[model samples]
Target: ELKAHSEFRFESNTSLQLVLKRGTAEIFGTELAIDIPYNFNGVKLAVYTYHGAALEITGETIVEYTSEETPMPIYYNLHLALEQRRMLKKSPRILLIGSGRNTASKILANYAVRMGRSPLYIDLDVTNGSTLFPGTMNAFVLDKVVNVEEGCPSSTPLSYFYGQTSISTNMRLYKKIIAKMATVLYKKLEQDEALMDAGMIIIAPKWSDSVGFEILQHIIEAYQVTVVAVLGNERLYSEIIKKNKNEGVEVLKVPKSGGVIDRDVIYRRQEMSRQINRYFYKVDNEFTPYSLILNYKDVSVKKISEEFVAPTSALPIGATRIVDDIRVVDVEPSSAMNHMILALSACEQTEDEEAIAISNVFGYMCVTEIDDAKQRMTLLVPCYGKLPKPYILVGNMKWIDHQ
Candidate 1:
């Protein structure tokens, strides 16, 4: 039972189902449809109530508790202000920057969808992709409230394979990819009035240091951010106010919820593993992916080589350095590729470097095995029938199935 002004926070590692028995409550801004069994798997979230509520919860949870203190009032009022802007048809591209674990942006995104607006959800944190895999950055159109049981939307999104779970792996490639993504997605905003009014909610990683803060500034320009919502961290918020130096964008400090817990590196790795499994097999195992065997002559596999670029000050005066960061070179399959994830590129051919690099992903597959002697490989794919394309892009990411 949850009393007025309190929220129930839970962390479940296994399958969990929650039912609202009485009164009214919501999860992440979307109100629960009473009597409906909402399923959760390997997720940490909260169910909050304005008045009071009783819940029927089943399955195991690692952590479960009630917090009387929360930042709901500040968040709800922010949502109301954002809704007002949407009503006036003034597009508000809100950038949510905070702790890596904060879900303030998601709450706002849910609020927008609940209000019948289809805001574009752009996720920049590759550690925990909201719409797709762990190492991908995607901009998904949340047209309707995400089904409570399914968790993530099944529809394919406009995605770029950053190839690394952490941006620190290849910051140049990460930045360039975001720039290209901006050019592609921003055009859609210019063409559709309704979508323009609906706008975007960009979720970014914490600005922990000088490098991260610089990247945040780059993102603000690339996404054409109109508003910046800093959650909880007062030092980070003050730094943005003094250093960001962008007067056109409105910045606000929103208190973080008491339920927000900092997840350690080990926990993040575990979540990434779960995300990979969820992508291929799904949360409930309702779908069965097929095993595809292809000869070396029929298919193409390419891998990106991560390159490091020196800072501008490191270079000599009046000299400019050029780096090929997006290059994907053909690689012969080896035993090392076992359990490696490959992005199914939308492009049919990989001959053009630029086209292959910029192509959006339609699906993903894992290289389960490679028979070097037979010159054939076995792939585990989530889609039915033949793959839409023959060209596949490989990155440094690998997933070892614990199950």
Candidate 2:
């Protein structure tokens, strides 16, 4: 690995005649000579490999040369020169989306700041009542705030059996509130163009909602901005890819095994802090080109995982199923388990008072299920109404059978 010119010296016992040829041969400058004998006992002959890859011997005899200096290692100097070039090309704009959990966002933010760009943190979730969003705001208060709207509710009622109710109406109200808030936030940015000039950073949560998708679409369509980078969950990243494959977006998902975001805000804060430290302290100034080269490595590896992992494959298992007797009112957002229960309960016929009482207590219920030893049956329970078929079988039993 180390290449340099070295001088070889030897004192022979006899006046030995040696031919120094190229590659185990004797040579005198450009001439292929025969035996070259040492006349004196201490007489020295200079042997060197010149630019033509030919071995040459100086005709002048050496008497008492004390010290010899060789050229410095060339590779080390070459590497240093390359590093200097990389440092000159480091850009400042980067958009990092994370789970608000780990160090990914923090690292990127720190990198931006150290590189002379103030990081902007835009929280994607408008409903989750967590301090993570506010914490991000506090950390990067001068940055842009992009509040993404959570999309419309699912088109099914399955809460009654699970003891929950519909949240459609409430979600609609929440959406309006988010839109108003976003407009206000955008207005603030417009009023201060300086802040806008610093560019925007979108810190999005997992993109499992229509709202997140819509927000990204809107931003790409409206703004004349370049998305320098993306960092987030694989699922969310896939959604982004599906939507913008042709846009040449660069997404970087932290490895699942290597301290990535996982819905924990404290972890996220710590990770972000560490990233800031690394970016400012550890990463070399020559990291930009290397990072760019490895940018697609993570994305490609994640894509491979998605293709081979059956569990990760997208499925329509949660899609709405037909309820013969049950009348689905309005769609709403709820936890996945709650949604399943409500869907099963919506197949039964119930009295108006009883339905209202159940709705009052549980929010909204549209399905019911009765489990037997051999089989389980579903009842489509319409809210405050009667269905032609009181019991419409949806699917075979599983939980009851296992029990």
Query: Pick by lDDT: which candidate is best?
Result: 1
Model 2, CA-based lDDT: 0.30
- Cα lDDT of model 1 by residue, 84-111, tens digit: 9999998889998886323787678888
After TM-score superposition, the amount by which residue 67's alpha carbon in candidate 1 deviates from its true location, in angstroms, is: 1.3
Please, what is the TM-score per model?
Answer: 0.92, 0.30
Evaluated against the true structure, the overall lDDT of model 1 is 0.81
Candidate 2 on 1-403: residue-level lDDT in tens? 0112432333322233334444322111112233443232222223323222223333433332211242112312322332343355422223444443222333333333334444344433322212121111111332211111101111221121111111221233223323433454456556764444444444433444645565555444433224523443576767666776436445444332122214356543443333222222222222221101111111111000000222423546765543222222322221211212122222235543223212211111222343333233332222333332332111111111100
- Would you list the C-alpha lDDT of every candidate in the order shown? 0.81, 0.30
Q: Pairing residues by index, what is the TM-score of model 2? A: 0.30
Shift in Å, residue 235, candidate 1: 1.0
lDDT of model 1, residue 400 = 74
For model 1 the local lDDT of residue 206 reads 44
| lDDT for residue 326 in candidate 2, whole number 0-100 | 24
